[model samples]
Target: MDKEFFTPRTLGDAIGVSQSSLKRWADKGLLNVEKTAGGHRRIGMEEALRFIRESGVTVVKPDLLGLGSEDLEVQEDELSSADRLYYALHSGDETRVRSLVLNQYLDGRPLYEIFDEDIQPAMARIGLLWHDEVSGITIEHRAHDICLQVLADLRFRLPRVFTKGTAIGAAVPGDPYTLPTAMVSTALRGEGFSAVNLGPNLPIEALLDEAKKIKPVIAWLSVSHLRKAHILRTEIKELARELREQNTFLVMGGSQIHKLRLDRDPYVLIGKNIHELVSISRGLVANIPQSSESKGEFS
Candidate 1:
């Protein structure tokens, strides 16, 4: 899913409107806007699509917003699903959420595809709603709980056919987000790895210690927050150096990873999404010789 948020200028450029006009719409409650901690206005992709649909605005530069003309058609088909799921989540309607998610899964979509194309985008929209003050913290928490439950259920249902190797994944310290790690772990498992997800807020030292103990084929660190990028870079570099010595590949990803100027390390793989992470994990597992003691199994 495209998880990009945009500035008014970028949105204006894409939709062929003046920035002042966009701001005016925001002020008139025609467009929803979120404010950053520093008070800069931000717009989510879903909201942009909504505005385009409702106002009959032509999106001339869809690529500037990580979308295409075809996406507008997709928006027409899937927007209602996303909208219903959002409202169901806010109202704590687990059954409806489950039915909607399961309908996609039962329609023969792969779990990873569902996560990347549907669930993640839905969550991103809900997150923006929270940021825009259209939803409360309780609603956000409830939505997360439902999402985790659905993911867990899907993980249990995935066929364990390929048995590649073992992988350990975690969110970095101070990054207390869970869904990204869960997505990584599920993607690894789908690729036939014995995946262990040490979810959110794990200190670097502790993660390194676990890596040493498990001797995994891949160690993944996900960073979702951009605050303290310098500290995270230092910790990640150290972890990469240590994992390199152990011949354990390190995979790092998340929305905020692009902000860091990381050194070029061949053993350290950077993934922008779950699909990339799964591809990297498959490649690493394929090239590395499995230890005699290592056996792949669901954990």
Candidate 2:
């Protein structure tokens, strides 16, 4: 057994693996390590024991000299990739965005999660700063464009044949912001629903046309701005009534809806969070209508 118990560098060097490889393995439940105050990863003796056991290697007395320092180096390389991505997003560095997105996709982080957690937060920060300084708009726009490109890269696994049940989502009028809608659309796709994303500036008529054409069991409207939501709600109420007659459920969300005054409109449902929307969608999927059952018209 090696004497140094909690030294990340020494142990990683001893094991001849990159620290990032060690971290990834750790993340996947293969090893244990202590993260230091300055965000550095350190390994302990118990962790080393666990790693050896998991690897099914002969438990010879561990020699620190022969393994080489590849582990620490690999860890650095992995961290470098994440760091570079963060830096590019923050600085509006477009040159490396495509390559970074491809690498991230290969690393197994879902595109929707990345857009929701990383890209959205990055844009929100930039947007807040842009209000105080005129130049911030350029940075915000660049980040947003790059994020859209990343979203476009996502390969949605559409069903080979026409499906009975599907879901539709869009941002309501005056809700030009699109990231949230995009995020929700991806989540729908992941949930096995054919999501027809109509993008921004969706009038009630256009939404109705889409709902009729797609014949989805569920329709989602996102409203990020409150004033626009107030205006859109009137239109949505009518559409909800119309959709309910056709046996379609209408769902509304976003910060705008969060602030709105909601009533007990059976035709309309409001989701407070992404999870709620997903649950509603799942229920809709499970309750799909059969061809023999004609949807009853509601008053």
Q: Clash number for every model?
A: 0, 9
The lDDT values for all models are 0.78, 0.63
Which residue segments of model 1 deviate by more than 4 Å? 1-84, 131-134, 160-162, 295-299
Residue clash pairs of candidate 2: 17-70, 17-71, 18-70, 18-71, 18-74, 19-71, 19-72, 19-75, 20-75
Tens-place lDDT per residue, model 1, 1-299, is 34458999999998899999998999999999999899999987656655765577766676675543333334446566566667767788776677566445544555667777777777887776666575567688889999898778666655554377678989888888999999898888777888889999898899899999978888998889766889888988999999999888999998887887789999999998887887787688678776655653544
Expressed as tens digits, the lDDT of each residue in 153-232 for candidate 2 is 44222111224356787887777887778767766665555677888767879889888876777788887865554666
User: What is the overall TM-score of model 1 with all chains considered together?
Assistant: 0.68
> Cα RMSDs of all predictions?
18.7, 14.3
- Cα deviation at 89, candidate 1, in Å, is 2.8
Q: How many clashes would you count in candidate 2?
A: 9
Estimated TM-score per prediction?
Answer: 0.68, 0.61
For model 2, give the 10-residue run with minimal summed lDDT.
65-74
